[model samples]
Target: MKKERAKVEEVSTTEEKYAQWKSQVPVLYDWFANHNLVWPSLSCRWGPQIEQAVYKNKHRLYLSEQTDGSLPNTLIVANCEVVKSRVAAAEHIEHFNEEARSPFVKKYKTILHPGEVNRIRELPQNSKIVATHTDSPDVLIWDIEAQPNRHAVLGASVSRPDLILTGHQDNAEFALAMCPTEPFVLSGGKDKSVVLWSIQDHISISAAADQGSTKSPGSGSSSVKQDSKVGGDSTTMSPSIGPRGIYQGHRNTVEDVQFCPTSVQEFCSVGDDSCLILWDARVGFNPVIKVEKAHDADIHCVDWNHHDENLILTGSADNSVHMFDRRNLTSGGAGSPIHKFKGHSDAVLCVQWCPDKSSVFGSAAEDGLLNIWDHEKAWKAKERIGTRTRSTSPGLFFQHGGHRGKVIEFHWNPSDPWTIISVSDDCDTIGGGGTLQIWRMNDMIYRPKEEVLAELEQFKSHLNTCK
Candidate 1:
């Protein structure tokens, strides 16, 4: 009888805990839904200092957070479905905390100690491999599956890093990009240089290490020498884990770099110098076509139109977004932007072209608004899709404001055309950390205008209650 009583108590305790967690889920979801915040229900334990968030797919999210401006930042991989769903969301969080684990959720403290991670990018072809750049000169490549034992406290299996690429002497690397079709990665730094690293050798060495095979020369070593130099560039080479080719053209800090979506051999870099230079991988780092004075102020972000290879978009500190056509550039002269978008009240920090939509693009600004623009109508006023009154805002299709601070970075889900995730630097309440909000295009656009307005009003009321 006593044994049965004890069993009953244990079952009751488990049920109580689950019930408590389940009850809290709706409250949090309502808070977000009421405000039309569109935040994922799954919250991170680490305070809101998320620097960047990238979606691996519809199912997974990678978030990098910096704590205390120090080394060993936290890398969190979250399950997007578990995050967005109210039904098993709390259970998933509990499982994560217990470290019993879910298939898609995991967190690790990066082993690299040089400085705060400046950027984290998931390889386009291989989502398993993530590249991280720090204030230090090295870019570390971590294999998510390699860290089996990362949750040691949870008694998980152990896994170590696959490779690390070093040799950038620039003070700090602010941008990193991986070619979609090639086994190459690009790093741009403060020293006005961009270096490309080949991953072929690293992959071989990593495979050998995983099998516990004999180490090759410089295998498992943090640094390796450059095998060869291309482009006749001034950057020196050591056999250490250095760049395969060095490209030097930017006169100021390289803020962002991206490989052309359709061509593996072509890539572009934007910088504080207000120059956007396109480079050919085969011809080394020299600019194939340089657009001088691309913006009036520092250009913070650049992205290529997947559908139109010649169309490039840029966002700048000058509070504007500009589009350029590479085919029309004149030699030795600045090319005028074909379309200029003016709406943001502050610096436009980031811009991204929708992967599925050729004519649609999104921009985030320091003004705390994410604006969607369509070139189909604005390309020629006569071809406009919707009604355009004399008083209508030009080029602007939709405006979303949920972040209380500057929206620093945002990305559209490649798998879901309607979804986007945005990260901010701070929050409205004192001591509140940063914020990450997920927005749906359907709610922001396809819904009835009256429905959208009602949700906005509910959100305002929720804010007042929080205050």
Candidate 2:
């Protein structure tokens, strides 16, 4: 009975805090859009830009709908109209209903997935081509542009995958990534292995067909097709391709994997075993460098810095983010981290380096806050005088407290500078399905104080002249 009372108190406290946060949204965010989901989404990703205008741009957004068996699980392809910076009114951005959908987002199509979509990654070479990890051993690839849209009703047929990646001996549900430099795909699974496959042949065939090839796509890699329902044309079996190579290093379920932004041959993976293994395909199947004891608990996510290949970030159930310089890493020890960020109150779920800035990165967690950190501030803070009386989270310049539940996933918009899309599983806490938010921090908060002060001075002078 006492525990239940404590739980009630906690919920009440959270609600009060959320109320306060909501009231400050206009001042904290330059622009904000809140779209309530009908079902919870475990993953969300930004797709390619489709259209651009003076005021707004339309881009494709990918999301998953994890349904309750009465309906089929689906991969949603939506069109999001991103308002250009400073275009949206502060009042318009803040005044949004928690129960209503946003006008800026529209569902373009839906693909009924074979299983619940655990993760979704777009091929950098071709954004329309996406790979999804499900509760299966195989990774399903879909050409979102070519796939026939379907209604996600009960007993509906699963949308056929354009290509299927088969390698893992056990379920490969979560860890998935697409190479930025090449048409390579990477995945980690319960089999304790990291698998790599090149979809170059598939991409070539697709390109040739686009130019009017008479021959159908086949005869490149070893392909297999099997019938399950054994009925009709609607019972489609997708063509599957085996992995080019499989690297084994992790002792437990691999939770996340990321490719070196500049190279397809180099990549990294983090797992439940609390190990970070860096792999170079050119060297061999063995890990180039394995960092033992990378975290205190299961490492949930990892990100390789795009601008600096030497820097790697890992977030773990230990509720911390660690930055490791690959050049200084050694195997068989508590891997040395240049710095450890302790900001989240719970397990960190996702981490991504900013597309525009190398030193900036975002970490989302179960703590209901997405903390944005700039590691350069750690060293710079030391040069300041009387900045604090006690220790605080270094480099944490911003905390996005828009969600009332665990932030499942978030993606930084590459096209729209400083804009971010974040989703949270809010069914239990807020009594809604989930919350999808698109927001950008106010420029006044992150801009250099001196520059901002100068701009304010100019504004004040202009106001005095008008008076």
Candidate 3:
């Protein structure tokens, strides 16, 4: 046993108080190690850097969200990390007026969902409770002194979700990113930039948010969409998309992003500027690897094929989605999307592929409509079997996700690919004041997978017969 000793210079009282105040540091674990304390910290554990503070438990986490001159959102216990599944433990919405002054919490809340736990650990350093609790929303004004009982408390209505990914300035629409390498959520706001969060080892760290009798008013749900794919090849597919790396190298705000379904790292992005960038996660700044005078107008959405990592698809505000190949850029051929999905009347908001159906991706527009892009018939090659001569058309159930508002975001559930999760606001088609809606695919809907496979098979047989 290594003997760990505390350099205690003070025994007690007067002169010792000055000595202890200056010298007293913190330790992690205290044991009978020759009668002393020991603190353990990571020398260099291979993990992502921590960019922001996060309160967390094993199964959940909470984030502090702040914006200029406006109330912000806080998470109770939110986990969207692909690998580890944490529910949430504690959370708080922090508002700092003056540091040393008695900091009052306008929104101190705690959540204990089933399978979630609340805990705290003792650190030998200067300690403060990271999480807290309140009886109701009006604890400060309602007088915590008068109403001692929490049974009658209620939280004022506001949709404080479990995660806050992006921060904002003056409420402008800021873009945010998720660091797949780090479990933290990144955000950007009024500054027109980005912020990253680190939340891996906050377990048992004191959380400020605590459960209360107050019913949170106007609480609603916000969701993040991860993966979308077009079904292809009539073969078994990998459940997850890959060659995963942060796709960077944009000079402006990235308008749309998509993963290459067939090639894990092969993906594409279009910027607010008229530029298209292609990348492989394993590769770097060279991701300006592919470029095109993609659109005169700003680019809107980018998508990739389930079977071809080289096949890149894009949609733009210019009312067009173009396909390009990796070889076309390298070989200098007249390479572009084999066909353009040219039916939408307004700017396209989102695009995704039906994971179960080949050559199918869904597109949403400002016009409050969803279009199913079926590429099976879009391609017209002399030979069609496993060939890139595939074509695209409208899908059968491309309509409102039961919402009558303008869709801002559309996501396909990974577990159930046909399920579309769309967020729309009051003016569009999301009927009532733009709520997030979950729409189910029609069971009676039809997909021509078997037919496409049969056609490709016959084409292959013809080639074989000729050879």
Candidate 4:
């Protein structure tokens, strides 16, 4: 009975905090949308931009439905209308219903997946081509444009994948990545090994055709062995291909993997063993540099900066984010992180560097907060030690407190500057499956102070003339 009371009190506290955050949306955000989901999603990703208009833009979105066993899991494609910066009025942004679906987003298609989709990664070479991790040892590939849309009802046949990359000895359900420079896939699993595969032959043939390619991505490759599905409906079974290489080093299950932005041969992985290993395929399947004790707890995620090849970011179960310099990782020795951002109060789940800025990054956690930080701020804080400037949290500049539960995953919109899409498992807190939010902070908050002041001064002068 005492524990029940404690649980109720905790829930009431969460409600009060959410109420306070919602009240400040108009003042803190330039544009915002909240869409309630019928089933919780473990992952969300931005797809290719469809069209651009003067006031808004259209883009494809990918997400999943983790069902409750009554029905099969599904892979969903959605079309989202993104409002242009400074175009949405304050009143319009403030009056959204939390329980209603946003008019800006709509379902485009649905694919009945074989299992719960744990992760979705779009190929950089072809955005329509995506890789999904499920409760199996293989990575499933899909061509969203070519796949037939199916109604997600009970007893529906599972959608067939365009290609399958098989390598792991155990379930490869979470750690997955696609190469930025080439058509390659990387995955880690319970087998405690990192696997790599090349889908170049698939992309080459697809490029020659006018319409989307119907050819199996790995059909003609010498390194990849294709096995036809033999079952009740053979047409519905996808062809599977074996991995090119597997690197083993970690003692526990690998949690995440990332490729170096400039090279297909180089990549990195983090695991439950609290180690970060960087591998160079050209130099064989052994790790080039392994940083032991990278975090005090399991590292859940890692991201290599697209702009700065020397910098990498990792988030951990220890409720902290660490920044490491590749050049110094070897020189400074093991466990030498350049800077640590201790902001999240609970386990940090995701961390990614901003696509537009080299020094800025965002971290989401189980604590129901997404904090944006600029590493350069740490140096500036030290430069003002003796002055009147007092710093509380040096690197953190923004805190997104909109979610009432743990933020499962989030992605920065590469097509839209300073915009982000995030999903949370809100069933326990809000009596719903989940909540998906898209928001962009007001420009005045992140822009240079002098520039904002100059613009406001000019606007004030124009208003006086009109009077």
Q: What is the lDDT of residue 139 in candidate 2?
A: 89
Report the Cα lDDT for residue 181, model 3. 32
- The lDDT-based order of candidates, best leading, equals 2, 4, 1, 3
Candidate 4 residue-wise lDDT at 16: 94
lDDT for each residue of candidate 3 in 342-461, tens digit (9 for 90 to 100) = 766677766656666756777776655566666655453223544443343322234442323344556554443354445444331111223333334333344356875777699899
Local distance difference test, candidate 1:
0.63
Pairwise TM-score winner, candidates 1 and 3: 1
Which candidate number has the best TM-score?
2
> What ranges in model 2 sit over 4 Å off?
203-220, 227-234, 331-334, 382-391
* Residue range 140-198, candidate 2, lDDT tens digits: 88999999989987677777888888888999999999999888999999999999988
Worst 10 residues of 2 by lDDT: 226-235
Please name the candidate that would achieve the greatest lDDT relative to the true structure: 2
After TM-score superposition, the amount by which residue 179's alpha carbon in candidate 3 deviates from its true location, in angstroms, is 8.0
Q: Tens digits of per-residue lDDT for model 1 on 48-72?
A: 1223334223345666555553223
Q: Model 4, 196-222: lDDT tens per residue?
A: 988775555456454764555434332
Q: Report the Cα lDDT for residue 385, model 3.
A: 42
